[model samples]
Target: MTSTQRPRAFRIPAADQTGAIEGDVAPPSTVRMVEEPFEIVEAADGTPVPVAPKSRAPWLSLLLVALGGLVSLGIGLSLERMISDLFAAAPWLGRVALVLLGLAAVALAAIVVRELAGIWRERRIELLRARAVEAMATRDHTGAQAVVRDLAALYAGRAALAGGTKRLDTLGDAILDVDDRLAIAEHELLSPLDRQARNAVATAAKQVSAVTALSPRAIVDVAFVVFSAVRLLRRIATIYGGRPGFLGFLRLARSAFAHLTVTGGMAVGESMLQQALGLGIAARVSAKLGEGVLNGLMTARFGLAAMAVCRPLPFIREPAPRITDVAGELLKGSGAEKPAP
Candidate 1:
């Protein structure tokens, strides 16, 4: 090398090539650029999207209602003509028939009066429950205690709810504040009573299979199913501190039918549980063993639904009774040995 050689120019090495020490060199970026998943584009004013209308089976229902009205009118006319003919032939017999008809009408009116009274009671109880819930939510100890007292009085005859009522009463007398009292009431009183009511419905559903299995005719099966469902709903309602009577049963039946209609005629008969438990109305009409079983299951579902409708108070923490579980237990042919699913 020459004595006076120029100094070599220094150059920095790339990190990738030289493997620069960590924390000494800049690192590659971890960020990525991405397009937005969706874009909102403004649409022209007055433009509308077309959609199919939902059918609630209104037309079919209307048609049936009209047909029923016509039939009822025809029956009334025919009955009137027959009564006139009977009066002309035998005035004494005609008078007796009139008296019997009047008595029957009076009996029907009495039933209507009883139903109205029960409905009034149900509304009052429901209002009480709502007020109690509101009081609990607002942390009003005095109001909540008053509600508890009223509920206890309403449930005086319910032996199963005695413990819960007593516990609630004790809470009202204790040093616990509103929140504690409400929490304890829900845990110690409402929850247990709810469970007991649900268990009662389940137990009734389980018995449906046993009772229906013994029926010789489809009509008999259907009758037994309906009777069982009415009893079950009443039992469940009573357990939950509600009074379910004849009108209550009718209300529940109407709801069940409406449910069937709204489901687009989807056969409840396909479900094994529906087939074995309740409302076998579908089964009766279908005239199939499988359909009958499905109808039975439907009846159980209706019973559970009726209980919900009849309950004076909303459930605090417990879940509503499941028709599937109750019906499943019945379909398994082990009503006594198995509990609800």
Candidate 2:
């Protein structure tokens, strides 16, 4: 008797098909790719997650390090000379200077500790993401379970996730498949945080758009943009459990920029601008309002990059945030959307 395999559904191939396999990676149609291709792998969900290429030598990091060292050395020397002069001038003044120095030293030490902790938190997120990727690649159920436990621990303190965290804790002996487990973890743990992150981004975009439109001076626009960006980065990190301090924020920003470069996010950002402009045209937006839309688009673009960096897990159970989605929301709230007649 002859036996035949059942018919299967068709998909547009991203690569040439061999009889045995379609391609080395998942199809691009399944994944929402940015301009650059980082090579796609199927995520915990059927959709693929694209990994960005490693960036070039970290010149920004080197510059930051050199500048920090130089400033620190200059400050130490200045303080020492000040204390010496004060002591020579008067004993009481010297005692006062010493006391001030001690207090400053303690405060400085505390700041250093917080910065290190922030860096560690960012690193921990990177490690966890890597682990999940590794588990997905290898189909290592044990490793995936461990990753889930670690993720649970990371969000244990999040009041919103308390119930999900407890449920995740019980899944160790329940879920068997690696992808299924990871997907479940993402659904339970990262879903609420994803909503919050999206909200933060949406709010920041609207604020930047509003401020830029109304501000008469370029400097005002620049200052507000910077302020909003820094706050948005911190808020995104906090949402994802990064809790980055200043130095950590710098590191986070660098990673976000790297991500942007590798993913060709700037081009997509341009696409966002184009989309916004299209909306603006329909609504007969004024020149100033149009400019505001572009500025808001830029902020939203960078915020998306930052969101990608801060996210602890890859997009598994949900679609990654698209520039168009955020821009649509931003435009609808502003004067860009067409008015109902």
Compared with the true structure, all predictions reach lDDT values of 0.62, 0.84
lDDT of 2 by residue, 161-249 (tens): 99999888777588578888999899999989988998888889889988988989999999999999899999999999999999999
Assess candidate 2 and give its lDDT: 0.84
* Overall local distance difference test of candidate 1: 0.62
For each candidate in turn, the TM-score is 0.49, 0.74
Candidate 1: Cα lDDT at 290: 38
Each prediction's Cα RMSD? Answer: 14.6, 14.6
How well is each residue in 152-251 modelled by candidate 1, as lDDT tens digits?
Answer: 7877676766888777776557766755555565565566656666676566655655556555677877787777777776676666655646776566
> Clashing pairs in model 2?
none
